[model samples]
Target: MKTPKNQFWNAKYSTLVFSLAGFGFACNLAKMLLLPENTNALVFSLEALAMLFFLALLFVAINCQKQHEKWIKEGKEKSAKNIKTLMDENEDLKKRIAEYELKENEEKRFASYQEKMLRKIFSDGKSATDKEHFLHLLAESFAAGAAVLYKESEPSGQFIVEEVYALPEDFIPQPFVLGEGFHGQAAQDLSPIVVSSIDADMIPVASGLGNTSTGWLYCLPVVKEGRCVYLIEMVTFKEVEIDKMWNEISTRLVDMKIF
Candidate 1:
């Protein structure tokens, strides 16, 4: 766990030790040279001992230098690995942040689209056909293929289709009474329902009229003055949480004076 800086310092210490040992050996040889001819056998023995000691010190110093070099190389390797790990982590963080930002932008754009649709629907003197166009635009924005607007007829007590868009040209609008079908139940309760599987509780209707009934369906009630004034139906190939999206749409509708 020693850092590169510490390794450098250690290497310097080893070099210093080696250099000092060599200097001491040179000083000892100079002292031996300054001795007179009368220097005794003991002096010669002492000289030999000094030479042996210097050699031993030199060996130790060389070993220390090699060990220091090894440690320095290992430190460099570890430092490189640490730097690489940090770089990789930083890149991953950047990618995740970018993804989150993109998702946030998409949500904002979808909200703006919903607001525009609501404004078009509730504009003064807007016709049923105009509202149908707005609904279709809304569905298209959400990537849905078909959309329908249904309202309850008070005289007949039946849910009559008020506007339909993205349907086949030959398809005809149909009516259903409360408690009779899924759409009727959704309207009567003023609640939203999402059907992931069509075979669960749905009654099969005519299919050749561009009503595939092969994918997910969403029914959302549009309540006005404590009564359901309209029902929004959407069909899609993938399961979608239309209720959650509807909550955001409703908030935008209120803000835009569409409800």
Candidate 2:
């Protein structure tokens, strides 16, 4: 596109060309009326000057027309380029949105699978073996490296990790108190919690003892009779959209009577 500055320059050129043409015509008319016919030299000189002025005016008009055409062509090219760029950007955004939708569908499928497994666990009279199977299924479905079940220790007023899966053979699960650690806090609040970074604030620095290799944490409370009975802990290497996923999972858990 021709910018505002270029348009202003073009207008100025047009005005100057017209003004010169008018001045040349006026001078020619005056010379024909006032100058004496006997003065041949002056008349010829004046006529030559008028001819030169007219020629210059014609040349300038042609040049200005060419410049205007060039600017118009450039403006069209720029508009085409801008349209192509916007179309490319729109396509890229559509592709990204499709990929995200596919990922979201996969997550929902995983959540559904977890719900089925939990239903089976609870349907089997809440057996110890069933709970173990449920924990294992959750670990696999959520792609977590480890999953643990924790129960509150009333005597010590702490929450103890009762069952853990995919843990190192020698690693021991520790006890933590309410508001003391991430897991405990989740259990205390009866709300799901996610820690994206271990080094971040609000997460206990010393709480990640055995799982130093993992960077993210997910904690969910297993509520029973409107109270937190157990806590599900998951450790992952990458962060998950915990709030969004948990909201969906919580709804499924309630529907499946696992909450």
Models, CA RMSD each: 7.9, 8.4
**Residues 1-259, model 1: lDDT tens digits:** 6555766777688779778877988898888888888999799889989899879878886887788688868988898999999999999999999999999998898677656655654453443336666576667656787878776788644767777767877777677776556677777786887767665356654321234456777878776666666677778777655576675565455455453
The window of 10 residues in a row where model 1 has the poorest summed lDDT is 204-213
lDDT of 2 by residue, 202-256 (tens): 5354453344434777888766556666777888767655444564555555556
Per-prediction TM-score to the true structure, in the order listed: 0.51, 0.52
Candidate 1 Cα outliers beyond 4 Å, as residue runs? 1-44, 124-216, 223-231, 236-245, 248-259
Local error of candidate 1 at 184, Å? Answer: 9.3
Error of 2 at 36 (Å): 18
